[model samples]
Target: MAFLIRKDFPLRGFATCGDCGSNLRSSWSKGKTKYYPYYLCQSKGCDSYGKSIPRDKIEGAFADVVKTLEPSPNTWCGLKPCSDVHGMRDWLKPKILRV
Candidate 1:
């Protein structure tokens, strides 16, 4: 018997360049004995010249960051959502109307 498998991709279209504010894309090299995937910036007139960052290096760095993440009561309190409404005054609201 055979089984079919599926995967979910949450990072399909969100990563971007910090310099040009452009979307980053991924590609795989062809005609190779082994697979190699990389990410590149995809923007016109941008200084980022589609440089490739190795998948292994990126994953290792991300693993380090994840390992450093720790949760505590103080950390949770520091992340509380803001509840201020000072900017909702009549004068501060947008002056446009639509039908």
Candidate 2:
């Protein structure tokens, strides 16, 4: 299949090439009947240079990994029930964050 290209890339700066350590560039590739989003390594000599990873695959994995992260316990000052905007304000107003 041949691809038609566009320049915008949501993961442009944050994602990198796994084989060459160059950044992964992204674009919308036109498929036989549709447009597909792909992330690819564009470094000149890399073994994985032209291979394309579907955008949903990479971004979905990224989101999954992000879901596993948590703020450090020491950095959490407090949590109060968010019943309303005023309640939220009340919760935040008195606490001096721990870290």
Collision count for each candidate, in order: 0, 0
Q: Write the per-residue lDDT of candidate 1 for residues 12-70, one digit (tens) a residue.
A: 23334656755456666654587676656777777775776565554455456557767
RMSD of each: 14.0, 12.5
Off by over 4 Å in 2: 1-8, 73-99
- Give the TM-score comparing model 1 with the true structure, all chains together: 0.51
| Per-residue lDDT of candidate 2, residues 1-97 (tens digit) | 1222234544455566667766677878998999998888888888988899888877776677667767688645665445564555444333322
Worst 10 residues of 1 by lDDT: 1-10
lDDT of 1: 0.48
Count steric clashes of candidate 1: 0
User: Residue 40 CA error for candidate 1 (Å)?
Assistant: 1.0
Instruction: Give each model a TM-score.
Output: 0.51, 0.63
Clashing pairs in 2: none
